[model samples]
Target: MIDFLTAGLVLGCSAGFSPGPLLMLVISETLTHGTRSGVRVALSPIITDFPIIAATLLLLMNLSGYHGILGGLSLAGGLFVLYTGYHSLTARPVQLDLPKEPPKSLRKGVLTNLLSPHPYLFWITVGAPLLTRSLKVGPAAFVAFIGSFYLCLVGAKIVLALAVGRSRAFMGSRAYLWIMRLLGALLTFFALLLFREGLKLLGVG
Candidate 1:
């Protein structure tokens, strides 16, 4: 239980630290719109997790009866990672024109999260391993684990928002491009590793 909790915390923090499209969204929103916009973007993960968790649960259940489904999932996850990596590498940095009228609704944040496959792919490969494996943890421990995760995730986002707000010039388009490209390369590395493991599981290259 102790190990699981620690691992969960570390995993959550690591995932939150990554400057992916979501983090870019937050930076763009905060710099262009307001801190409120950044907050909305940050919480979009919570909103997006409902269907993803359900789908993961269903997939886990269905695949429990089969030997190869896990490998298939791993391959799919790898493909998604590769695609996102390519996008991140090639995608343009967002420059904010700052709309004169604010977006009154949270539609952009919500819709981006829901429509993207990244969250589902990430949770399927990475998040589920931490949460679902903690069979020894009681309900209280589970709650604590989840609480810690959200604390880390949200805390990171808040810090990022503030940092972007404070140093808008530093985080401007040029830095954004390089950071995103670096992240893309890192994600591509993850893709290759996962793909290799998936091939091993499937007894194929």
Candidate 2:
């Protein structure tokens, strides 16, 4: 259970650090709608992810009859996390093509990730099993699991938004190279760990 909590937290941090369509929207909101909207974007995941986790867990419970399939799905989920982390570390910021306002753009960003297949895939494969396995340790253990998972998942992003939004004084003086690069390195480690966990599911590790 400790191992599961640790791994989920690591993977959650990796995912949160990476900027995506939603993140881009958050930035746009920060620029146009002000820092508050970006902060809302941080909280939006709370609205989305908990239900996602629940729905995903229910589905996985139904599919529990097939261990091999479950294992394969876990491997796939792990690989997807690895890919997203790699993409995050290397990702170039999206260039704005159309001149648009922030609110609409932010809404779009929120919708994109929420509607994307990736979140469902991750929860279905990796998160559900990690959670279900933790639950067998009892309810308190499960609550700890939930608490630990979000502490990294949601908390990391909120801190990130706050840091970037608040960096006015230090902006341009330091390029934020060190911290960004350090996150990239951590992301890489996170990717490998997910791969390892996936392999464990497949009985390959």
Candidate 3:
């Protein structure tokens, strides 16, 4: 249970802080409009991720007994996570040279998140598999992983929006850099674990 929660939190934080279209949209929306707009943008994943979760869960649940397939997915997830971590480690400071756009914060956020491949890839490879396992563990474990995930995921973006709205320097601060690096290291560790799990499932070294 604790392990699931920790994984959820760490993955959520990494996704939230990692440089991406959504994060940029959060900052740009905040800077262009206000904290409220940014917050709405930050809340988009809550709206967009439901169907994704359902679809992936349905697909993965059917294949729960297929360790070979799951092993391949775990390996892919690990690689994707490792790539994300590398991006975090080498992340550049937030660039604030955003062009102004009309303030349809929530609408734009929903669209952007819907169109983005990150959520799909994450859910299919990493999230759904974990969720399936959590379900086998018990209801509480399932809730813990999902709940902690979105809580931190949305929470981090909302906080960033607030920070950017108040002081743009926060995004480009040294503290942000250090935090990203730390998260990157943790993500790398998780990637290795995934690889091991994948190999074990595949009956390989």
TM-score of each: 0.64, 0.76, 0.97
Clashes by residue pair, model 3: none
Writing each residue's lDDT as its tens digit, candidate 3 over 1-205 gives 2278988999999988887899899999998888999999999999999999999999999998899999999999999999999988998888776878899999999999999999999999889988988999999889989999999899999989988888999988998899999999999998888898889889995
Among all windows of ten consecutive residues in candidate 1, which has the lowest summed lDDT?
127-136
Whole-model Cα lDDT of every candidate shown, in order: 0.65, 0.63, 0.91
On a 0 to 1 TM-score scale, where does candidate 2 land against the true structure? 0.76
- lDDT per residue as tens, model 1, 1-205: 1344553454445445455666767777887787877777877777777678777766675565453766676677678767767776785744544444465425666776787766776778755533553433556665666677677676767777777777776454576567557667766776776677567668796
Ranking by TM-score: 3, 2, 1
RMSD of 2: 3.6
lDDT ranking from best candidate downward? 3, 1, 2
lDDT of 2 by residue, 79-142 (tens): 7766665665565534432236646543565676698776777788677777776777777666
TM-score attained by model 3: 0.97
C-alpha lDDT of residue 106 in model 1? 55
Error of 2 at 171 (Å): 9.8
| Model 3 segments more than 4 A misplaced | none
Off by over 4 Å in 2: 88-110, 168-205
The alpha-carbon deviation from the true structure for residue 195 of candidate 1, after best TM-score superposition, in angstroms, is 1.5
